[model samples]
Target: MRAILAPLWNNAYLLMTLTCLFWAGNSVIGRAARDLVPPVGLAFWRWVLAFTLLIGVAWPYLKRDREILLKQWRWVVALGALGVGAFNTLLYSGLQYTTAINALLMQSAQPPLIMLMAFFLFRDRTGPVQIVGVLLSLVGVLVIVAGGDIDVLIHLRLNPGDAIILGAMLLWVLYSVLLRFRPPVHPLSFLAATFGIAILFITPFYVMELMAGRRIVPVAESFATIAYVGIFPSLLAYAFFNRGVELLGPGRAGVFLNLMPVFGSLLAIALLGERFTTAHAVGIGLIGIGLLLTRKA
Candidate 1:
């Protein structure tokens, strides 16, 4: 198993692709389970379970990197608060009132936001080709989001849920930009620290949720949702995404986020029995072209 997985670990594109895939599934599951689980509670338990699962493997690294983690405590805490704690909580909460289509469309804004934030924060510059690629991919996303009808966008209305999702997206951009300052430690150590800290950051909100009587439903589907989220999106996706950013830098790594809506559309078709349409094919093609152009640039 180690031999098979070892080679893939060094492949940044593969790692980012898998990260988006897991995250896309997370959105679908979060939306589906909104009524079954409270948003804050889901975020809290997801990180708690992730920390529990990872700490065993990360213990040695955590001990070895204790001093470095301490010196970089601010970065760790900020990342935990924004990325793991706030982002998922806001996303799930938004999904409760917004359509998945709106959420995915809003999510498509991350790549450019990441690039812009990177530039302002670190003087990271993007080439003209890269900018074009980003815009092209964005058009593709809009194609998918609008179901190939421009009127869909024109007729769209802003709701409170959309505002919440937009806030989540902005928080994620800040997190991605800050990843450049991550502590120079083993990836496991960093992930474990962040996951643990995120659990702490989310505790108050989770308690408030419970106090409000918004507890998770005690059903097999709810349990399954929690388990899947804990393992895949919380544990593996963050691990993969962080490594991808380490390898590719935030700007390049951010482009992979554009793949989420593509995967989300395909997943919807497969899981929800939605029909595959011409718009899907065209949007996917444009996104592919954009990715290739960005890679070359």
Candidate 2:
């Protein structure tokens, strides 16, 4: 098991790419299920299921790392609140009103945001090459967001949903930046602790959502959405992203998020029968070049 997993665990690029793939799928699915699953309710259950699935495997690591975890409880709580609790809930909430295109456009801001936060908060410096790379990727994102037409951006309007998604993006940026300070513990131990904290943090909001008459519709599609979100985006994506950040640093790791829109576009074509266009090819090419440049930096 160690031998098979070690190679993957060491491959930061692969981890981050997979992370974006899962997250792209997450955005698509979240949008599709918005009517079926309420935001806070979806978030609450997503963490609940992730925690349930993780705790069993993490128990031994938790026991072994109890002292370290307890010592670093503050970081655990902060990360849980920002990354698992607020970000995801707000994302789902925002998706309720926004088109997936708008959401992906919002997501494109993450790399620069993460870079800026890292610089301001920690004095982390970004090189010129990285800056150029980020700009290229941003253009790629714009091409995709605008559906190959620049005029679409001119006519784009921001609504409450866009603001909500921006707020979520900011929270995730903070989470990614602060992950540098995470305690030295087994990945499983950290994830388990944070997952538990996320559940605790989200409980009241979930209850309030219930009180407000925003209940999840009980249906097969809702269950399937919950199940997929619980396992892929919640469990695997977070783990892979955290490790990728650990290996590559927040600035570099964040550049990979540019791929989310790229993958999201392809996923749409494959799943929704959307047409593949020249813009997608050009945008994907630019994003690929940007990633390679960032990697070199």
How does each model score on TM-score? 0.98, 0.99
Instruction: Estimate, for each residue in 143-260, the C-alpha lDDT of model 1 and write its tens digit.
Output: 9989999999999887889999999999999999999999999999999999988899889988888999898899999999999999999899999999999988888889989999
Off by over 4 Å in 2: none
- How many clashing residue pairs, candidate 2? 0
Residue 171 lDDT in model 1? 96
The C-alpha lDDT values of all candidates are 0.92, 0.94
Clashing pairs in 1: none
In the range 171-205, model 2's lDDT, one tens digit per residue, is 99999999998999999999999999999999999
